[model samples]
Target: MILFCPPGVYRAQSDTELLAGRLARHAAGRDVLDLGTGTGALALAAWREGAASVTAVDLSRRCVAATRLNCLLHGAPARVHRGDLFEPVATRRFGMIVANPPYVPSETSVLPRHTPGRSWDAGPDGRAVLDRVCDGAADHLEPGGVVLIVHSQVCGPEATVERLERTGLTADVVERARIPFGPVMRSRANLLERRGLIEPGDRLEELVVVEGRRG
Candidate 1:
């Protein structure tokens, strides 16, 4: 499906595709909340999968608009909101919450306030946003609901699993992909190696889909 992706709004990449594949397993006949939605790809995917309802949230106005445009362009139904992480949908709960949030470890500890960096620049350890997602996920999910998050193994998938488990959600790595560095990762290879995130001369990274289920 065609999408309205504007500058600075993340386009569907390897991680997005990875998450969307798993999303098909759980989206049908359920309400879905897509956090950090970019270009509304996951939101539209859930809708196409027969989601009862779809709500997409993003921190950037560009992303919100892009998602809204994509949904409108495809005649897909969705409620698009602009806010950081889950703030826009604070009072809402869903049967499935999906995310392809920023997880690339960056040199800066502070999240980018301006610049395309906001799309992929997680903090040094790459958990700035991931941690928050894990922490607050349990509260916004329905009984028997599940949350799906996709990120790089470089960010420490174990940490994410542990964090989600702490929130009372049973979590584990459900899918994985070993992919070559994309443009962004390629550009940051030196930084990643310097930060001890990757072995020297390593050009490929593993992406994992972490799924957390609430009993």
Candidate 2:
């Protein structure tokens, strides 16, 4: 995904948002939440896709600042906040929620030399962030609302489905994409453990997305 913004504003991009943009079918005038809106990419996309109101949140002050600027750049009335998960928007719920949270695993995550954004970490098994998002998803989604997220095959879509189901939310793989893990974040073993892709003692190699919605 491309990060479009002026030089001064810090920006970050995620392949998850690229997939979310394609999967999001929100209609205009519907309220939407763009969680972890690093550069407000998803929020901007949601607005462009016809969302009536788009609110975004990020844990980093830099991200919040950048999102605000980006929203203005696109003339979008997106409310940007700095907080973890749903802290900033606790009082409000939405018809649609879109996020590309930091699903990277901690053990494998090696901070980039020039990290531009805050939300990319892949977690302890690359599912830390994804798991948290799924756990609290049901409470925030409005009736009939759906959440679109991008994760890796490394996170095990099947497992993700089971987790969401426990919360009364149906899950699906809206889109799938891959990139070799040799480049960024190491720890093939950790990735395999999260996805259960390995045989009790095998190595790992791919990543994918697992999308879900309240049932």
Q: 1-215, model 2: which lDDT tens digit per residue?
A: 34555543334444744555564566466788888787888888888888878899887767778788778877888888889878898888788878777655555446432354234565556676777788887789888877777766656778778888788988877666555454344545555556655555543344555666765
For all predicted structures, in order, the TM-scores are 0.98, 0.79
lDDT of each: 0.93, 0.69
Tens digits of per-residue lDDT for model 1 on 107-127?
Answer: 889999679999999999888
Regions more than 4 Å wrong, model 2? 1-14, 108-118, 180-182, 186-207
Residue pairs that clash (backbone atoms under 3 angstroms), model 1: none
Candidate 1: Cα lDDT at 37:
92
Judge candidate 1 against the unseen true structure and give its global Cα lDDT, from 0 to 1. Answer: 0.93
Q: Candidate 2: RMSD over Cα atoms?
A: 4.4
**Candidate 1 Cα misplacement greater than 4 A, ranges:** none
In lDDT terms, which candidate is top? Answer: 1
CA RMSD of all predictions: 0.8, 4.4
Could you tell me which 10 consecutive residues in candidate 1 have the lowest summed lDDT? 1-10
